[model samples]
Target: MYLYGASGHGKVIAEIAEELNISITGFIDGNADIESILDYRVIANNADGLEGKAVISIGSNKIRKLIALRDNQFDYVKLISKKANVSKRAIVEEGTVVMMGATVNSDVQIGKHCIINTNASVDHDCMIEDYVHISPNVGLAGNVEVGEGTHIGIGACVIQGIKIGKWCTIGAGSVIIKDIPDYAVVVGNPGKVIKYNEIQKLSQ
Candidate 1:
């Protein structure tokens, strides 16, 4: 297996790969300055002649998507940490990474290229869409639904039955008790919309 992006996120993914007994061929990154990471040879992201499965170790949902597009020729693989408690009933898609100590309960459907970060708990029957980032230590009650490209920040809590819309960001440490709309940036106990995602406009 080959790991992409030889940064901090890559290091964690490498550790997870080690725990899974997955042999890593090397690391790849767009940055030319990094020659080696954790004693593994770091080559240019576009370097050729390497084959086999690859994982995108980037933390940012946007950047990960960009990098995945750049390396679309390679077969993307999922990275689930051995330490994570993922139920057999859950469905995790390709290119997603479930970090160590994360708990994914029964009937959870996590989409492609997501980051279920360390210690995050996603309760039963939750639906997480593509390119979402459930940040470290976040909590989602049963049946909660997160839309595509949404970012649930670190330590955030989402109540059961709440539907967060596409491209929204639930700020760090916030408590979500209500539904959030598309392109909204929300924070605080009730998780109000502080601002709309202006980038969504440009994309359209």
Candidate 2:
């Protein structure tokens, strides 16, 4: 399998693949200048005509979504690290990456092309939509709903039954105790809405 995006994120994915004994053909990068990562050759500026499975390996939810939507040729694979504690009852869709030390509890529904980053804890009955990024050490309580393209930053904690809307950004170390609206940029202990992401709104 090939990992798209030759960066630090891609290196993590490569490590996970190695842990699973999966053979990596190389990396596929948009930047021509990036020749290699972890001694693996990088195919620059072209995903076309590449056979076999691939993982996006991008940290950015928006970029990951855009690449998945734009490049439909390669078969996208869901990557779950061997060290991850994923419940059998969880439904993780294709193109999603569950990183090492992550814990996904029962009845969690994680959508396509999502990132459940290292050591993240997603409690039971959570619904994580497509392109969502649950950053390292983040915690989501039971029944928390994270909408499409939303990014929950590192070490952030969301309370039970909270609904985080689409394209929202929950800042690092934020404590979310209430429902977040669409395109909102939230931060602080109570996770106040610092601003709406006008750039994301305009892109849509």
Q: Give me the candidate number with maximum lDDT.
A: 2
lDDT of 2 by residue, 1-204 (tens): 999899999999999999988999999998999998999999998988887898999898888888888888888999999899999999999999999999999999999999999999999999999999999999999999999999999999999999999999999999999999999999999899989987644355
Runs in model 1 deviating more than 4 A are 47-49, 200-204
- Please give, for residues 6-78, the per-residue lDDT of candidate 1 as tens digits: 9999999999999999998889888988999988988885747666799888777777777777668788889
Clash list (residue pairs), candidate 1: none
* CA lDDT, every model vs. true structure: 0.90, 0.94
